[model samples]
Target chain A: MSLLSVRSLRVTYGGIEAVRGIDLDVAEGELVALIGANGAGKTTTLKALSGMVRPAGGRVTYKGIDVTGMASHHLIRQGIALVPEGRGVFARLTVEENLAMGAYTRNDPPGVSADLDRVFELFPRLSERRAQVAGTLSGGEQQMLAIGRAMMSRPRLMLLDEPSMGLAPLMVQKIFEVIQSISAQGVTILLVEQNALLALEAANRGYVMESGAITMEDAASALLESPQVREAYLGQ
Target chain B: MDIFLQQIINGLTLGSVYAIVALGYTMVYGIVQLINFAHGEVVMVGAMVALWVITALAGSGTTLPPLVIVLIGTLCAIPACMAVGYAMERIAYRPLRNAPRLAPLITAIGISIILQHLAMLIWSRNPLAFPQIISNPVFHLGGATISGVQIAIISLSLLMMAALTLLVYRTKLGVAMRATSENPEIAGLMGIDVNRVISITFVIGAALAAVAGVMVGTYYGIAHYTMGALLGMKAFSAAVLGGIGNLAGAMLGGMLLGVVEALGTGYIGNLTDLCHVSWISSDLAERCAVDGHVILFGSNYQDVFAFVVLILVLVFRPSGLLGERVSDRA
Candidate 1:
């Protein structure tokens, strides 16, 4: 069974429909990329899956449980964590405190502490400035902290939204490398990105979304070589 | 010199009460940005609850130790006021959370009115004498005389403020509260229960207000339905003066306002007398002296000083003495 299954998912913002209808599936331990243009509903789909937005219509099942419309916090307990769009770090909190909050739903203190160490190892920059307030961190560091915070939750399935949104090219490369390592650790990932080339390079399978619908799904390498994808996304 | 010392003590006591109440305003404002005008009514309810509990216990003809009686009254009042605060949030404020900013504020005023009337209906408009649980044993510090009650008020208020500071800055729950205050939507995305955190903020604020209410009653030896009105406004001013959303700012603002009022009360008369203003004229001064009053300004004008300080603070540093915390977005 797939780890997450979304069938005909639809989301609306007031009178406008942001996500018309889409179907997708992620098996356990698969790294899937949802790549699209600015308004192709990639972010909306991620929001719906993470329970940030209620779907206008659709069934979202996680591990065979109908978990659609469950509140985001509840979803976290079920081992789903979203590292939200634009890296929403708690700016007022210290970096260490931000990581501690990531483990909020859990009760095992020793396990939480171990996860804290693991997050620090994953993002050494966060460890170097753990005592510093998160707001003062540079953009790249903030993104790293955002990702590290999600990792602290020990999620079985991680949803990353625009992880490389506004970063130096070098920082973007580092973030994608971290993503590949996280995927290698056996965590299923659904990564949403406008940086299609990097996302496809890092993902095992890729879905191309345009105007609220999936236009194509194929192996990442195959899509990278496809003429239409090369012309539209890879800028070849 | 003795009067100066005495006024300092008085100022500290009054400031502590304002600090406690201001914390409620600051915390609620920090989390939801709601003025919570009903907060004053919560304080009134707390005092009334304590009064009722004490009155009931007294009427039972079983004499309990003074400390135990006061403790029981406080314990009962705290929870009663917490329930009122929780209900106010859930029923009046929560529904209007997504409404325009003015909606929750107006609802808060409406709640304040409802609570005031409810207390008046239950306790009547007459002022009730608070039981003297702590004896007033006078002790001299330098030239000023201090009472046991005053010491208790000052020490307890300081202790509570310290504990609250530690809770906000040091605990796991504190992190959640700060995160929610920083950004509710993001905090929820981070797996924090935003609603529960907001509710807890109200509960903590209400509990602090209740303690302040009981302390005010004990200090003044009287509890009245209208007592919270002026106190609440003063505490609100204190919160704004210290920066509405800053915790340390609230405490500082409260104490500063108290000290200013106390010192003004103590010295305004003497200062006016020494000035010998031409506007008063020699003849008017002579007549005033004949009437056993030589000064144009007196303790009656002490309350004015608080407003003047508030205005100056607002005009000069609208963000407050301590800078206000701005919610940073991604």
Candidate 2:
């Protein structure tokens, strides 16, 4: 059974539809990528699935339970976490505090402490600047902190949005490596990215979205080699 | 020199009250960006509750110790104010949270009006004389005199501010509050219940305001339905002066504003005397002078000084003396 299943999810902002009747599923331990251009409803779908945006229609099930319209914090307790678009680090908080906040729902102090160490080990730069305010960190460091924070939640499923946006190539490469490592650790991932090539390469399976609907879905290698995908997304 | 020292003491005492109240404004604004104009009404409610409790106890001829009576009064006031603060957030502020910024602000004003009228309806418009809970003799410090009440006000304010600082910077709850203030959406994603954190913020802020309200009433020996209006405006100005979202900034701003007003009231006439404005006609200058000093300004103009400081701070350092804790717009 899939870890997460969204059937005909819809989201609207103001009077306009953003994500319209889209369905998707992520099996346990699979790294699935959703690739689309700007305004293709990729972020909105992620938001709706994570409960940040309430779906105007359809059901969201997690682990075969109907978890539709559940609050974000509730979803976190059920082992779902979203590292939001633009790396939403608490700017006024120190790096250490941001990581601490990531473990907010957990009451196990010793476990939290161990997780904290693990996160620091995962991102050594965050450890180096643990006491520094997050706002002062560089964009790459902030992105790292965002991912490290999500790891502190010990989520079974992680939704990553635009992890490569506005980063230098080296930093993007480092981030993709981290994503690969996280997936290898048996955490299911649903990644949304406009960088189609990198996302498809990192993911086991990929789905193409256009105008608020999925246009194609296949194994990542197949999509990577497809002539249509190459013409539109790979810029080859 | 003695008069100058005396004004400083007076200023510090008044400043402490403003600082405590200003904290309420700063904390609430930091999290929700709501002005909570009704916050002033919370202060009034606190003072009224304290007054009612103390009066009832006294009327019943309960011979409690003065310290115990004051403590009980404060204990009563804090919770009452907290309830009002919580209700304001849940009933008036929460539903309008997603509405345009103007909606909550206008609702806050409406809440303030309702609170004022409710107090007036219950407690009446007459100013009740606040009983002296601490009647200790005044002490002398060099040239300036210190009343037991003034010392209590200053020390308590400092203690509360210290406790608040520790709470905001040291505890897990403080981290959650700060996180929510920084970005509610992201904080939610991190599994922090933003609404709970925000509600707690309002409660803490209201508790502080309650203490200030009780202190102000005790200091002035009067409590009335309308007393919070001017005091609230001054405290709000202090919050702005310190940088609306900065805690330490609010403290500094409150004290600075208090000192300026006190000093301005004491010396404005003398200061004006030193400045000879040629624009003033000789007849008018003569009429404005009292005992060879131009008395264009006096203690009556003390309130004006707060507004002047506010305007000056707005024009010069809009971010406040301490820069505001503004989050990055995602």
lDDT, candidate 1, residue B138? Answer: 91
Candidate 2 Cα outliers beyond 4 Å, as residue runs: B272-294, B324-330
- Specify the CAPRI tier of model 1: high
Candidate 1 on B35-151: residue-level lDDT in tens?
Answer: 988898888889989988887887687778777777799999999999999998999999988888888988888888888888889998899998776668999899898898899
lDDT of 2 by residue, B234-301 (tens): 99999989988899989998998999889898887777663366345866565546445555666788
- Clashing residue pairs, backbone N/CA/C < 3 A, model 2: none
Candidate 1 chain B worst ten-residue window by lDDT: B321-330
User: Model 2 reaches what TM-score against the true structure?
Assistant: 0.95
Give per-residue CA lDDT, model 2, range A113-219, as digits (tens). 99889888988999999999999999999999999999999999999999999999999999999999999999999999999999999999999999999889999
Question: Given candidate 2, what's the lDDT at residue A32?
Answer: 99
Candidate 1: list runs displaced more than 4 Å: B278-282, B288-294, B325-330
